[model samples]
Target chain A: MSPVETGRRGAAPDPSFAPEPAGAVPVIVSRDLTVGYKLHRERKRLTALRDISLSVNAGEFVVLVGPSGCGKTTFINAIAGLVQPWEGSIEVNGRPVTGPGPDRAMVFQDYALMPWRTVESNIRMPFELQKLGLSKQEIDARVRRYIDLVDLTGFEKSFPYELSGGMKQRVGIARALVSEPDILLADEPFAAIDAMTREAMQGELERFVAKTGQTVVFITHSIDEAITLGDRVVVISYRPGQIKEVVDVNLPRPRFDYDVKSLPEYSELRDHIWRLVKDEALQTAHGAK
Target chain B: MSTPDLSDGGSISEATDPNRIEDTEWTAGEAWERYGSKVVTVINLTIFFIVWELFARSGAINQLFLPTASNMFLALWDGFTTTAPPGAVISGSIRDHLLYSLTNLSIGLFIACVIGIPAGLLMGGSKYVEKILSPYVWALASLPRIALVPLFILFLGFTVKMQITIIALSAVFPIIINAWAGVKTTDESLLAAARVFGASRAELYVKVVLPFTLPFIISGIQQGIGRGLIGVVIAEIFGGSKGLGYLITRAADTFNSALLYAVLLLLVIVSLTLIQITRSLEAYVAPWRRVDKV
Candidate 1:
């Protein structure tokens, strides 16, 4: 791609990346966001992200898709306050994020659940951390609510080691949601599970958010997953990753378990994303030069 | 260290499959294996005693050198029930000496743990603390403990103080090394999870670090028990006027083979009982340690 082609990528004023026309303020607005790492051992610098700008409107499901080694995780990690941007800024609710806080709760791919804690305690952690001023009864009630919402009610007393990969991620979702954050940041939360479980988790998550209208910025390399769950799919290019394109899904809410993949609209969006991601992967391989 | 969770990362429901009965009752093959093992152990002990008795009776070995099992048992019974013989240097019953040794062992283990565990935790927690203490800990742990018995005796004399110090010194190294290693080896992933969840430094150590380090501490305690047993015997044989160790030396010095054999048997029993207690303690604190055997 030429310099002009690179510039034309997600730089499209695709209105989809704009604040919702209904006057809801964007929950997250990242401007000129660039992040890099200093390889202290090797005495070199590795740039992970280039100047990228995006706006995520309130209650919107924004999924980031990219090739392997594309800075998708880094972009979300910047929001999670796990990584510092080398340049530019990320504003969560009109304020620049300084560090990890309760405003943004992360669901990691590996389901970072404490093996020793019961599912209820793990889900109840956010309140314990922030001391949210809720009464003990209120916290207990809320914890129970989220546990039921994630269909993990019976297993509330079970440890992470006792849960399956899918069950563990469900607990992770409950934990993240119980915090009642403005933005939910998930980093490939379903990547490790088998295909069948992953499909069901995607459906369960969509159903939960359909009622709650929670804002989620999910990062993944799966184009199909991005198309299935996202209202807008943000495609990042290969490393030193820049926004390549943003595609609007325009799919129905709670679209899961059915033959959603066979729909022409779904297939078209999938094909479009598949091609973008394929091109990005090829570019990453060739760009190594 | 505890054996890590052995569940195969399968579906959580599958991992705790309720229908999967963990059978305590042995199957035909297992029952045969179990009984076969017991029979082998009993047979081996019987063979050892028969050979020992025969060896003494055959005149191949002196009776004093290889006292028959009956003579040893009679001496043990007599020692338990009566006072020491008139010619003996120490006049108390065998019970008195056994109690003396036990007291030393307990006191030694207690002092060693009191000093060693905290030192290990500090060294493991802070690089600066480790830098200050590493040289001394390493030098002490590696030095031949037996050589230091002479120094202890010289400083404290042939008293209980020296005996206890020798035993405590012998037990301290394993506790220090293992406790330090246990803390240092706190799973990085667990710590990261704690940090992301906004756990403060104190909570992180209390909730995450200590529980993870418990198994290592337990294993270290087990090792110290063995070392402490050796220390007790060495101290008694070399210097102390009382304890099972003193009796063993007295029997040897006086050429009372039956008493020597009796004391040796008791020592074996005491060592085995100490090891058994430690093994059970290990099981209590870290049930996950035996996941492989299960």
Candidate 2:
């Protein structure tokens, strides 16, 4: 079955589900959040992000775009509770972030699927690691459903090494969605995929999250991808990163089906983000902060 | 303008249909492709033996140093098919010595694994353990295990205990080092993914690190088997009445050149068989790693 048909059927079983009442309630709030890493060898701390404050509403798709070393990944990692903020605060569900919890999950750029695990086992890893209050049958059903949702019904026994780049990322997507986390954090998830498959995957990602109502914080260097997938594109500055601008994308829902790339408004948003990022990108290229 | 219709389910279904595959009769070329290397190896070894047999018959070299291939095979056959007379000091049959050597090697390897696996795991899992144990491990592993044979002989006296100790000591270092490297080099992204998925520290080790290190440990055992074999022969040669090493020494002392050549051939067969078993074990446990070689 096509992903769209599965997504529709999957959403239909739950009548209480509504497309996120975006802008009505903020799920993630960051206030003066400063996060960095300690260089133990140098006895110094490197600030990857500085004094950043942003609020993402429930079910909103926020894309962070910047050059290399721009702390875009640091922001997402902070949300995932993989790293702590050096100053101020970052909160989820109106509570201060402490560490990784069941409410949040992340997709890595490298796919990061366990090489030893089959597709079915990899998607079931979350339940193995934590108590999700799920019965064995429920977990099995959800794993199978998500596998079908990602159109990987027949490849359940295949290992990561047996898969292509796109198929592996589909497994990554399925794994992240299986836990049904409220917030989905992706760090350059499609960076390694080939260009044609990446376009198709971006569309599928939109459809999946739309049906599931996940608040997504996606990181990317591509302005086109930001405009294509994001509700708001956040442009960040180079080393000791700060938010340069947050450009709202007023494009229609299911933008891939709408062929929004041909729209003049889409080009305008893409060009504006490119302009906002150009100086920082150049500075990054020349090794100047 | 005439691109194939990818959206049509007809071609796609047929391509992926498992039943569409049929077994075809093998042609001469196909049969050759499958078994050519094995046939070549048998023929090459047969020619080698024939040449050796001719040279030995020509008497170009001393029979004491180079026995005829037929004489060597005869000795090997007699050693297997018969047993030494009752109360003989040294058994003439190769079977007894081969059995003794193999049993010692197995016990020694088991003891080595028992000590080595935990030591390697502890070093890899804890920074403090690694710092404390690394210097000693490197020092002992770097020293040729042969150098310690005499010391063990002095300490335990030319007994089975001495031979076993030497074998264990020789085998343990490679296992420890390989397990250590495996744990240390586990892919970082896998760890990150596990963490993000709500794995605790202990879970990370159990679910991520241990599985990742298993293939390494197996390969380490493979190396250990080779080293342990060397230790076995050396220890037995130095001071023991029973093993292939002892047989080799006795055969040389009596100038039984055929028996000496037979023992050497037995050693080669034993080593190759053990190595082949480990290789199969490695491939079975970690089929994903085997993909790259093909």
* Residue A251 Cα positional deviation in candidate 2, in Å, after optimal superposition: 1.0
Give the Å error, residue B186, model 1: 1.8
lDDT of 1 by residue, B1-294 (tens): 121121221111112333545658778998777688788889999999888888888888888788998888888888889876766675436877898999999999999999889989899999999999999999999998999988988899999999999999999999999999999998875675566666778977887788778888878888998899899999998997889999998888878888899999999999899888988877766654664553
How does model 1 score on DockQ?
0.19
User: Per-residue lDDT tens digits of candidate 1, residues A1-289?
Assistant: 1111111112213222333345556778888899978899999999999987888877778899998888888888788777787888888888888777777888888887766578898898778777678999999888887776666767777777666788888888888888788788898999998897787677667656644567899988788888788888988988889998988877544456344687788888888888888888888788876
lDDT top scorer:
2
Q: Where in model 2 is the C-alpha error above 4 Å?
A: A1-23, B1-33
True contacts kept of each: 0.13, 0.42
Question: Residue A268 error for model 2, in Å?
Answer: 1.5
* Residue-level lDDT for A139 in candidate 1: 91
Q: Candidate 2, overall lDDT?
A: 0.86
The Cα error of candidate 2 at residue A33, in Å, is 2.0
Q: Candidate 1: where is the Cα deviation over 4 Å? A: A1-21, A34-52, A65-75, A153-157, A235-247, A268-289, B1-27, B30-63, B69-79, B82-93, B257-265
